[model samples]
Target: MPRRRQAVTIRHVAADAGVSLQTVSRVINKEPNVRPEMMERVQASIAKLGYVPSIAAQRMAGSRSYLIVALNDRERTIAGWRNREGTDWVDQMLLGGMLTCAEHGYRLLVELVDTHNDHIARELLGAIAAIRPDGVILTPPHSDNPHITQLLEAQGISFARIGSVKPGAGFAVAMDDAGAARLATDHLIALGHRRIGFIAGPNEYELSGRRVDGWRAAMAAADLPTDHLLEQGDFGLASGRAATLALLDGPVSPTAIIASSDQMALATLELARERGLEVPADLSIVSFDDTPIVRFVHPSLTAVVQPIADVTAHAISLVIAEQAGQSPSTAPVIVPATMAVRASTGAPGAARPGGGEAQGYAGPPAGAGIVTEVSSDH
Candidate 1:
């Protein structure tokens, strides 16, 4: 039988680095005021010795699980929105969390919870008992759920929140969703779009309301009326398409439309094609979620680039830090969002006799002259 190799220990690392085991322990725990040269020597010895610290041993030595649980709402259906592979927002969040956890020698576990369910607290408690995660990361809907936060607090579990409109207690990370929406709406307004349409996400999610508020704020600032231009959607492609079709068939149609999600924006593009409207000429479009799909689509969508992955990663980091005995910040960590102007938006056109463009305004230089194979079916 072959002999198994003995695992490297802190004593070995100390001997190799010419330091005490206590020094090795302090360096591994990332304590402050360690001599720089000694710290570097210890780190180099650890690398050269290929010593993989046992998370369990570390936990036993101090107090930690080195595990994180991310709770997301499973009731929110994506439907046709995620038909195109790799565009799912959940996938993005998971990827970000996993990567960040791996870097910190921590494991990430994802759990789906139906916050709307009557026994959600019980179910969450059961899951927590089974996993016993060091910390938890709450996604939208769950992020704002007071019950979940209270449960965590009562159980003595640390948690971080992502995408909460009113983040309360513990570590939280979120982007300025309403500000991003306002930026998108203002872009259309700047391009001479007065009668602009908005397709909003479902009201159950707090972010949906924040986005609506942003759109309303921008229109009000521009002295534009929004009563007739706003439409509600379920954050799905079908709802976006239906809402957009109804908006087009309404008594007064908008020259430019902004949908809450990239999938919704794609629906707007499809509907415009069905109605024989040329993108950026007959009708301009803007949307949120700068996912990878938006970049490859015909007339690449102009979108509010919400830092979904970044926020998730930051949320994981915050929980990890909190679990490591760091005090949680009272204020949420706010990530900034930016606009990615693509081919889909342009200056609005003057009215034609039958909703045709009297004058076609060219879009930005980057979007100019980019052609696609979509047919005009009107």
Candidate 2:
């Protein structure tokens, strides 16, 4: 049997550097007021001896656990979002949080709690006690839940909210969802779409209302009536498909439709094909989120590109800063969104007297333009 190498310890480094163990510990922890020459000697000895600091020991020396917990709601079912892999937004947020945590020498713990459950506070409180996280991050519907925030506050825990526009208390990071939705609507309007339809997400999310308000604003500005142009969806493909069918079968059909999410937008595309409508020729479409699915689909969708990953990273950074005894920023952090126009949108077809499009009326291609930053106040 071959002999196994022994693990290196701080004692080895301390002896090698001809310094006391306490001096080596102070140097390793980067404590203030250490002599520059002594610090250099300790570091060189540690490197030469291949000595690695144990996380357990580091925690014992500090008041922080250097761990953050990100809580997401499992009860909110976004249609066609989850698969064997995972949902796009959740995966993106995890990546952002994990990457940021690694950079700060911290660990990220992701938990899915059912916010809809009556006993959710009790369940979450138990988890908090077990994990004893240094901070927490709340995502979507969970971010808006007052009970969760109240419990965290009662426990004297630090936390940050992601994707929340009006995070009543505590730190928050979000993009201008209303402005993003308005940008999508304006894209269709610029392409000569007068009767534009909107498919909104579920009412459970505050963002859904913000998006609807944006659509209404755009329609009102263009002097267009929005009486029968809006349909409700649950942010799922099935709801989107059903809403599209309802909108198309109605007396007043829209030439262009903006679905609140990429999944719903794809559903709209599928339904349009079944109805024998040629994309951008007979109808135009725009979706939000600009997820990876939009790029790979045939007749790639025009979408509002919200910076989900960046917003999540910012939230995690805020939590870390707060845990490190830094004061939170007085103003909320707002990220901006852009528009990615592709083959899915163009000028509306000329309408006949009976609401049918005239043949050989292929619309011009959509122009590439940037979505300006609209004010976040809306």
- How do all models score by TM-score? 0.86, 0.82
**Per-residue lDDT of candidate 2, residues 94-205 (tens digit):** 7889999887767898888987889998899999988888899998888889999889988988888787768477687888787887887877787678999999998878
lDDT of each: 0.80, 0.80
Name the weakest run of 10 consecutive residues (lDDT summed) in model 2.
357-366
Give stretches of model 1 more than 4 Å off. Answer: 18-22, 31-35, 76-88, 350-378
- TM-score for candidate 2, residues paired by index: 0.82
lDDT of 1 by residue, 150-200 (tens): 999899888887888474666768888778878888778877888889999
Give the lDDT of residue 210 in candidate 1.
83
Cα lDDT of candidate 1 equals 0.80
RMSD for all candidates, in order, please.
Answer: 5.6, 5.2
